[model samples]
Target: DQVMIISESDVKSLLTLQDAIHLTEKAYSELNAAQSMIFPAVREEIKEYQGIFGIKSSYLIAKKYIGLKAGGFWLGNAAKGKMNHQSTMMLFDAESGEPLCALSANYLTAVRTGAAGAVAAKSLARKDSKIIGIIGAGTQARTQLEGLLATFPVEQVLIYGKTEGKEELLAKEIIEKGYSAAICPSPQELAGQSDIIVTTTPSYAPVLHTSWVKDGAHINAIGSDTRGKRELVIDRKPDKMVCDLWVQSSIMGEFQHGITREELYAEIGEIVNNNKKGRENEGEITLFDSTGLSVQDLEVASFVYEAFKSKFV
Candidate 1:
């Protein structure tokens, strides 16, 4: 009858970005192996506040974990001195359907999302890739950078955002963290210079175009998840178009805009399972169309729950 309640601080201390990456990667592999179940995402806009509310739920069979993350993004939260995106995760036992733990998931959401991009890059981006271009200056932008750095030997970071000074601020923070960084004057400049491009904005219109991108470059389109959101103008489809989950991305993800199901190369899980090929050559363009995944949240949540139990139970 009693459930463990874990705070944001506790989750922060328990899970690292690397840990989330590992768990998220494992989830993908398992999903491909038919060891997991991801229910459809439930997302809707709150017109009154220019906010979004959604629920992501999943079940990991072998891990015996069942959970869901509830909450969403509010554009006005910044004025209220709060994070734009907020969420809570609750885990239950898969066997008995008993509530096991509840944890503040703001941090988990960021890390897990970052992990998804990193995992995608590891499998698709060229090994020698060094420069990263990020289009967005928000929290997701920072986390996405963190993930790329952890996954690649990035020599430089390039940032581009519409908001004045935001890109500069993010660049300064990156430099302060001992990484080389610069603020690009435009998305085209950033894309032209980076070996890997990551889009993390909430733009409904395209921020990057095909002509701006170079061959052998990999792109992580993680910004657009809602129905009307978009980051890239898909004038030409990449050589390989991968998705974290086809069912979700094919409906509301970035690639959902002008790209069709036939254009999608494979789901990331299939590649992780070795059922499909990833990045066949250095001269090919690759794109990871991520819409986020409920299984990602479940895998990370289960890890946090276990870590908490071992320490305090």
Candidate 2:
């Protein structure tokens, strides 16, 4: 077995935003078709090592681009029960059962998550959106910025974070990437200036208020992947709402409190495939409630696996 361990740099060299978006859409479509099994039994808590360990795992096995991809993760206390950590894994193979590859999922997850948000922004955000407001200055925030810049012509970006040093550091890095980025004094200031706002924090309470959002703005809430991790107010509703998966979003995504499964206007995949219109009106406030789907991981992994195979063999 020739195990090819591709680094993040190697993956970046081989795949572009267009490639990632296409693969993500294809993965979501396949997942939507097989909705029955895609909705797995989510276990929030599990027993491990004769002790209680909190585990949030969702099983998703899908067929995409002539290969099978399985998505799962385990989150619990690590480091002698002093720290909290999560690990995600992906398994990929062709239909013939030939094991293709496995990857360290942190970067893969970040890229796919960012790509999915980009897809949502492409469909739901206004065409004239030039200013971006970002909350959280971490690894996920960087990818979100990269993905958004790849799809939209953002002119300025305002970032807010709890850590002042980290915020300034990220702002400098983002500015170095050729965008006008700065650390904002408050989330309100960030929200007021940006036409497109993306919140990538793990805040339990709302970090963004509805009153601060302007008309026709699009918001991508990327941090609220697990239950109780939301960044927007539950009482605040947007004019249009899109999600990666309705079933998953309602249960674990940011939409868990504000909207039900049936209330979602459209899935991002549907919008990407042109089955539904995104940003129909100019004054519409659109929200892309991202729960982070497994299909995205599967698609991106499959793409990388195929690229590695084609070049190596």
Candidate 3:
């Protein structure tokens, strides 16, 4: 009857990018295999606070895990010396319908999202992709870069951000990590130079244009998880389009703007499950539209909970 409480420090110490990537891939596979069920996500805008609150929940049938993550973007948190994105997750014993654990999820959210993008990029991007471009310089963008570095032999990183000093700071961090990094004047420039591109901005309008993306580029559009948010401007359909989940992304993800379900090649999980093809050739343009998934949150939270128990219980 005692619910385990895991803090942000515990999650940070226990979960690594590599672990998140593996868990995210597993979660996707489970969902694709019909072993997991993700309930409809709820996102609401707190107009007075200029923030967004969302809830994502899921049940893993095979693993017997059930959980929900509640959190959102608080625009004013930065001024308060806090992260803009904040959330918490609660795990439950599906069999007994009892609460099992509560976890801080800000860091979890970043790594898992990066892992989701990496999972898609691994299957869709060309094997030789070395130059990566990031569209935002926030926590999510940094983690996305970290995830790509773990998956690809990246040689250079290009970043573009609306904020002046943020991109520079991120570039410096990447340089210190032993990679060549630079700031681009525009998203178009970044896209033209990168073999793999990740867009993590919370933009209501398109930040990247279709014509800017070069052939053989793989784009991970992870910012638009709400009904009105968008990042990519795709006038012409991509050579291949993949997403985390068709049910959610079709309505709220980057594809929600103009792309249809018919245009989507397959979900990332289907690609992982070998039910559908990924990148067919090197010159094809590939896009991964991620709205994030509750399964990802649940799986990673469950992992953190287990790790905590094994060590501290």
**Ten consecutive residues with minimal summed lDDT in candidate 1?**
250-259
Ranking by TM-score: 3, 1, 2
Please list the residue runs of candidate 1 whose C-alpha ends up more than 4 Å from where it truly belongs after superposition. Answer: none
Residue 156 C-alpha lDDT in model 2 = 88
Residue-by-residue lDDT tens digits, candidate 3, 1-313: 6788999999999999899999999999999999999997889999999899999999999778889999999878877988999999999989988999999999999999989988899999998899999999998998899899998999999999998889999999999999999999888889888999999998998999867989999999999998989998897678898899888887889878877889889999999999999999889999999999999999999999999999999
Pairs clashing within candidate 2 = none
Against the hidden reference, what TM-scores do the models get? 0.97, 0.83, 0.98
In Å, residue 67's CA in model 1 sits off its true spot by 0.7
Predicted structure with the largest TM-score when compared to the true one: 3
Of models 1 and 2, which has the larger TM-score?
1
Number of residue pairs clashing in candidate 1, backbone atoms closer than 3 angstroms, sequence gap of 3 or more or interchain: 0
- Superposing every Cα of model 1 onto the true structure, what RMSD results? 1.1
| Candidate-wise lDDT, in order | 0.89, 0.71, 0.91
Clashing pairs in 3: none
Residue-level lDDT of model 2, residues 1-313, one tens digit each, is 8756666566666677678777777766666566313435253534363222232222234442322223333333332542232334444343455545555555676777778888788878998889999998876788888888888888888989996687888888878988888778999888888889999876778899866888889999888766667898844578778888777788778878868766688887777667788898888889998877655666677677668778876
